[model samples]
Every structure is written in C-alpha cells, then in structure tokens.
Target: MRLLVIEDEAPMRTALVETLKAEGYRVLAAEDGISGLELACTEPFDLALLDVMMPGLDGFALCRELRKRGKTMPVLMLTAKGQVDDRVEGLDSGADDYLVKPFSLRELLARVRALLRRKEREHALGNELSIGDAVIDFGRNMLHRNHKDQPISSKEAGMLRLLASHPGETVSREKFLDVVWGYNAYPSTRTVDNFIAALRTKLEKDPSKPVHLITVRGVGYRLEP
Candidate 1:
C-alpha cells in the first residue's frame, strides 16, 4: 500500500518511514504541514499519517483541508498528547484513527492493518474491476477479455484488485506479498513476477510483450489503464 506521513520531527519521521517501508508500504513524507498537504493532495496514497503538532498548518488543519477537498484516504493522527480532549479533537478534525507517541510498534502496526482492512472492505462493495478491455467479475472469480471469459483463482483476483487500486504507479513486490498475499505467507518475491506473467496472458493483447501490465524495471509492476 502507498502512504503519506506528515511529521515535523526529523528523527520520528525517519523512523516512521523506515518502519512502514519495512512493513512493505510505499511512503511519501514531508517535514512541514504545507509540504505534506501538497504531497497528500497530489499523490495516490491509500492512507496518511499526520503528526498533530507542527509549525504553520498543523495536522488538524491539514486533515480538515484534505477532507474539505473530498480526499477520502484514511488519516491517522500522531501526537504526544494523550488526553481525552486531544483524542476527540483528532477525530473531530477528520482523522479516522489516532496514535500516541512512544507507542508499541506491534500495536501501531495492528491499527494500521485495521484501518487499511476497513478501507479494503468498503471498496469490496464493488464486485467488478474494469481495466482496458478486461473486466473481472470478482464476485464470480472470472476474467473477461478478448471476447472470452475465463476462470481465475481468488489469489489472482485479489492481486489484480490491489494493483488496480493504484493505477499508473509502481506497486512494489514487497507490497504485493504483504497486502495481497499477507506478510507471513510462504510465497517469495518471485511469486509476484509469476502472477504478473499469468495475469498478462489473461489481460494483455500480447503476453510476451505486455502493454497493460508493464513491469517497472527494478521496482515492480504498473497498470496503464
């Protein structure tokens, strides 16, 4: 998954980025709220992590502006202040979740998972995926393309859904394993390539020279449609 982290502290921001990257997320970060807001508004991130205290625009204002602009990406507020009113303020400002400083990494990871899963479920209401000439009936595990409809595995459907969520952006192989296949799953990184190859055959006009499912040199794969 892609995430935006807006934090002022150098050390804390670095730590958050490294930690989330290790967990297989593509992250964009900014040290000030204005820069953060700009990046958040421009990028295709699945979530945002905002530090509550910052110079100028602050987390609350950034989040409120994001909501005002109709960006429904989930926001998680981070702060050292752990009082009742502070929590209420975070929520009132449009943050979906809040995290206190000096938090256990385990718990923080859990909250991140929960929020993303909730977002995933909300998107689940849509049972079809349309990319280029291909249409996937995820509800029925079928892929229709080139005037033919063929059966596909649940894992393949999940992989396509995840990749489709972020179009025209490279999704890392690590993210593929972590989100679609789960972190602890036994598949190695090569599994992503194999899946992509199979998917190309199903969705692309030429599997040997794929167009829609293009590999991003050293990073991962990107969907053009």
Candidate 2:
C-alpha cells in the first residue's frame, strides 16, 4: 500500500517515511503543505499522515482541500495540540482520525493498520465493480454487459479485483503473480499478459483498443475505473 506523509518537521517527516517503509508500505514525504497537496492531488494513495501545524497552509485547510477535490483516501491528522476543539476541528475538516504528537511508535503503527483495514473493508463491501458499460459481479463470477451475462474465471476475477482496488495505480506483473497466481504457479509474466488480453476481450467494447484496462508499456496494467 502507498502512504503520503505531510509534515514540516524534518526529523519527524524522515522518521515517518522510514517507519512506514519498514512496515512494507511505499511512502512519499513532503516538507510542506503545498508540496503535499500537489502529491495528494496528482496520484492515488491508500492513506495520508498530515501534521496539523504548518507555516502557511495548516493541516485542517489541506484536509478540507483534499475533500473538496474528491480525494477519498483516509487521512490521519497529527498534531501536538491535544485539546478538544483542535481535535474537533480536524475531524470537521474531513480527517478520518487524529493522533497527538509525541505518540508512541507502536500506537501510530496500530492506527495505520486500523485505517488500512477499514479501507479494505469498505472496498470489500461492494462485490460488483463497474467499468464503463460492463459490471463485474464477483459473487457470481459473471460479467454483465451488452445486455447479457458472461462467465469469467476465478483468476480473471482476482486480477480485476486487484486492479480495481488500486484504481489508476500501475500493478506490476510480479505483484499479480504473487497475488493471483501464487508466485511460481505462473512461470512467466506472459501468463499475466494473456489473462489481461482475455479480460479485455470479455470486458472491452473493442478489445483491440481497450480503454478501461490499460497496459503501461514496460510496467504492468492499471484499471481506469
């Protein structure tokens, strides 16, 4: 999973980036709110850690702007202020959770895990994933499109689930192999390409020129939904 850390304190920012990385997450750090906003708007992230106190744009304003721009990623507000009104303001500004500064690393890690788990649960609540005119029903292993129901294999469904979960993020072939095919179960990356082709044939209006499931040249594929 990917996480964005927006904190002005150099030492705290580095510690956050390193800690999240050590937990096996891809981390991006910004020293200020403007840079952090740019990163948050440009790409998709699983979660964000925002420091409430900043020089120009405070964390509350940043969180509000993120919500205004339709970024739905969970945000954890970090601040030294543990007062009631400050916490209320953070939540009112669209933060999902709040953490006071000088917090234990163990507690921070626990909060991160809890937020990520909640996000996964939110994604799982919907078994039907829609891409353009096609709707994939994972529960029944069927694709509903062209006014008809088409059968899709378990592997195909798994690939779609992974891609859909990440949305615009590029999912590498190695990641697909590990998640869908159980690593050595698929001997070559070519197997992934073939499965993608099959999915396009089934889901795309014109499989020769797909729009939803896109290939990223040397990289893997991304679901445009």
Predicted candidate 1 versus true structure: per-residue lDDT over 1-225, tens digit per residue: 999989999999999899999999998899999999889878889999999999999898998999888787878888998886776677667777787888987877887887799578648647788878999997677999878899987558767877777767899888776555433233368988998988888888878888788889889998887
Off by over 4 Å in 2: 127-225
Global lDDT of each model? 0.82, 0.85
Which pairs of residues collide in candidate 2? none
Give the alpha carbon lDDT tens digit for every residue of 127-221 in model 2: 79899999999778799999999999756877898887787799999878655542233346898999999999988889999999999999899
Instruction: Score every model by TM-score.
Output: 0.56, 0.57
Clashes found in each candidate (C-alpha, N, C closer than 3 A): 0, 0
Residue 147 in candidate 1, Cα distance off native in Å: 41
Q: What's model 2's TM-score?
A: 0.57
Residue 172, candidate 1: alpha-carbon lDDT: 89
